[model samples]
Target: MKEALKSFFGLDDESDDDELLSKNLNDDIAIDPDFVMSTDMLLAAIMEAYRVMDRDKDALDLFLTKYEHMHENESLRLMSEKKKKDPSLSSMHSSKEEDKQRLVQSANEALRTFFKMNNDEDARLLFRSLNDSSRTAETYIIMVGGLVEKEPWSGEISQLYQSAVQSKCLTEELAFLAMKSVVFSKLDGKMRVLRDIIADTSSVLNISPEEFNSSRYWQLKRTLGYRFAKLLMWWRNLSSSWEKELKLSVRQLKQGRQGGHVIDEDALRCIVKFAGHNQRDDINQGVPVSDGPSEKDQVIQNKERKYGIKLIREVVVDAHQTTLYNSPAFVDDVAIGFCSLKAYDECIKFVKEMHSRDLIKLKQSTYEHAIYAAEEKKDLKMVDELIRNMEDGCSLNIK
Candidate 1:
């Protein structure tokens, strides 16, 4: 080991100049991978010993300890700067702080390269080599993060996200960061990331019903809803029919492997709107594809309308089956979605049906949608009836 160290640093041990050489090597400016022990050689030796001894963690810990040692003094300088009160001391140590950051960053880069995470296939193989690899999240985050940088919206990103959540290695902060990355992926117009993240919603966002009232929750829901709408459009373009697209999109929304856990009403309504709009659009423009249909079929277009109604009903029924139906926004958003979809009769019918079911403590938006739908239909009597219903429900006696 001593001879190997000497050969690594081009040392002349016979000259009794060991102390001089060691001092020169230790100096901050001279400290580098080559003058110090060759990290490559050290790593190879450690790995060989580890393989023979049948150890993985110990070898990694050994490499980490040695590699991190190179930055220890610089890191300590940063801590000292943080603790010091004197302005002069802070100013004097600014350069040292920068150096410390650089040292730490360099160490991380070196670790990434050493672990072969800079190459995706190798990184994946390394993860798979571990038993119950998904639970190895703590060890694999940095490596996977580097891999994600190369392919932000790939199947691998979603897999890593799901694994990280499954492994319980995801902190709240990391969870939001990953979600934000998915939202930002849309700037590149990648719908797959949006769909994948939504598919992993229970793991990715995972907030409870209690926090539903918070502005942050609504904000996140709105952002997700908007993205879902865009994704709905993309799905529509990909499929031959709205039913196929809606089914595929619903499949994407299911939670865990069992396909339970419905998405909340706010985001679900976004999907509903797109499904209905395609029906309206197809009716207006004639069937996009030829299918043994007359002009009467175009006018009657009941298949698209029926499929839209079925899709929306399925979403609402799933919510009712789950605890999310109790959310106050549920009835309101569903009504608004129906109105937005121009299913005026369906919108009014939903309101009456929900009231009959007594499942809702109706919000003002529900009445507003009912009234708006009546007005659009030029049904004065229905408008008056909705106004009285709103007064009885929420005292919104609007003129």
Candidate 2:
């Protein structure tokens, strides 16, 4: 056994480095394969030795080329034939299954070691090279979990997730990890990442919506959609370029929902807030002209503002008509959106519908918007009603 260790590391007993090598190969011990030793155990020891020596890629390569093939169907078949003669061969069949599990465990250990060494390229390559049978979901999860923890802000993690999706190896847990990592990362192009996740989740649901219709799954989609919409707000400026981009974002949201990516209430809230801002910008445009915007620019702002108001009304009406998530917060944003465009009547009507559903506990800002909208419409009765509404559980701070 000592001689095997020496030979494994290209050493000999006559070498002067015996004491140092002894300390390094501490895991190597005398074992009888007939009693307890297995290929996985030996491979693990060698891989650990390789990792300690900073040659983890070699360990991965060894696992890929040799230890993974420990599951030999022909050997199992021969053993089955032998079992006909001797009942003792049943243990051999069980050992074969155990060896397969050990091989998977060994693969996981190698992957974790590669990640520990910061040799992500080799880890990625090793995972990709694995056949479908060898690549268990746990193996994939461990690889991605290591990557995310080691480098949470890396775009490479997102790419690895995409590759897993293409290979059909990305489980729901993996998808959740990838989504969270991407969101937490300071990486650019987050909207694109969200879109990718939406598409991936949609694919899974398309197969068996009933079976896979988990709350956690829908929650992930809702979180992604909300974030995507929040990011869209940065392009809310009335500049020509940003206007086009914002329009594209809105269209993407629509198309996503149409394509089976559920746009939940949280996402609609952000869109409502965005539309409110657009309407406010339009209101600012209508104020006394300055040397700031050209006549053509004012015309464009008016068109975009109209589009924004139209969007908010559509969203509010859709929420009311459909049995969707109509939280009080979402309804608050809807009220503010209508008031921003001085659409007092529409705002009040929607508020009443939501109030009837017990979803209209207005926040301070929404209360202020309602007050201002009623005043703008010269409706004293409406203003008094808003004051009464504020007296009942609504904050009355009008800024």
Candidate 3:
């Protein structure tokens, strides 16, 4: 018995367990004829071995063997004629619930042991070994919370997220949870995550980038625009080079048929915010109110500022061409906005299109909008012509 204990735990004679009726196959074999140990002692020793000297697989095999023997013994004891005692007691002998709890406990213990054994490697490998695709996704979902905290940038975390997204057995809510990870990754500034999310989202929304960049996908474009606006607000004081990089990055994405569907009010707001002059006329003090980015290297700084403002403004609205409007319902306001943006030709073209589509009737507001558009062109002749047309169309004689 002492020898067996030593063999099991690499302990000496003072070690605990001694099992009788056990075969010793190590050739140094000996079975203790007089030794006796309780099942409780055996369970305790197995748990201890798990903690101290990891013979986890061996311990599990031994536990299963013990379980079969104990189950047989209990069956025999229950069937005995001497045990025909009490009906109530026999009814209470249903170990199903206990068996369920034991199985759950064993599963938890196995997971603990497996995870503890394999920290440095991807834990997905363990699930793969178990051949459990659904469980793999579930485990990845749980692991992501911690991974997002510790190593959010890890490629392994990304792989796990991808697996969860591709899972076949996911519930709708679970699938959304996986997509939420992709959104967070984009918010974290991962272009790869952003691209994947955009592709999936476009597929679900039945939109392609070709139709997306015009007037088609306003809502989706606005969502991304809001996110970009928040980022631009944070970039208030960064250098001109950074600003240029940001603009160029967006342009590259747009040209590549990626990023926001179209630049709308929200996106324009972001651009305007970025291109704002930090200084304002303080009429009260009769001087300039200046903040952020001192006037050092005035030549280079002024050049960049002028170039940036002009560049981004043109990117949003071109004075030489008709600007695109998102929706046809409020396109009159869009036409006026284009006029305000100095896009006279675009304003004229837009109003013409709206009239052709019967979207804007020949009414007082239509004449007024046409007048505004013509006035932006700085042609008194065109403006007078529109006034005469307005009088003819609406039959208003107001001079």
Taking the tens digit of each residue's C-alpha lDDT, what string does model 2 give over 1-399? 334433443333443322323333344753332222256667667667777877555555455434424545437658778658867576776765665656765677678886777767667766765566566767768787888765664666766776677767778778767776777778788767755665576576575432232223335545445434334333344445334434544664576557855455544555676663544634322111222258887776667657767888667655664444356566666766676665677777766555445443556555556667778788899888877776663532232
Question: Regarding TM-score, does 1 or 2 come out ahead?
Answer: 2
Of the candidates numbered 2 and 3, which has the greater lDDT value? Answer: 2
**What local distance difference test score does each model get?**
0.51, 0.59, 0.43
The CA lDDT at 295 in model 3 is: 64
**Top lDDT prediction, candidate number:** 2
Clash pairs detected, candidate 1:
none
lDDT (tens digit, per residue) of candidate 1 on 34-78: 343344344445444543454433333333434344356446667
Considering TM-score, which of the candidate structures 2 and 3 is the better prediction for this target? 2
- Model 2 weakest lDDT span, ten residues long: 283-292
Q: Is candidate 1 or candidate 2 better by lDDT?
A: 2
TM-scores, all candidates, are: 0.35, 0.46, 0.28
Runs off by more than 4 Å, candidate 1 = 1-248, 251-267, 279-294, 322-330, 340-345, 353-365, 372-382, 396-399
Clash pairs, candidate 3, are 322-346
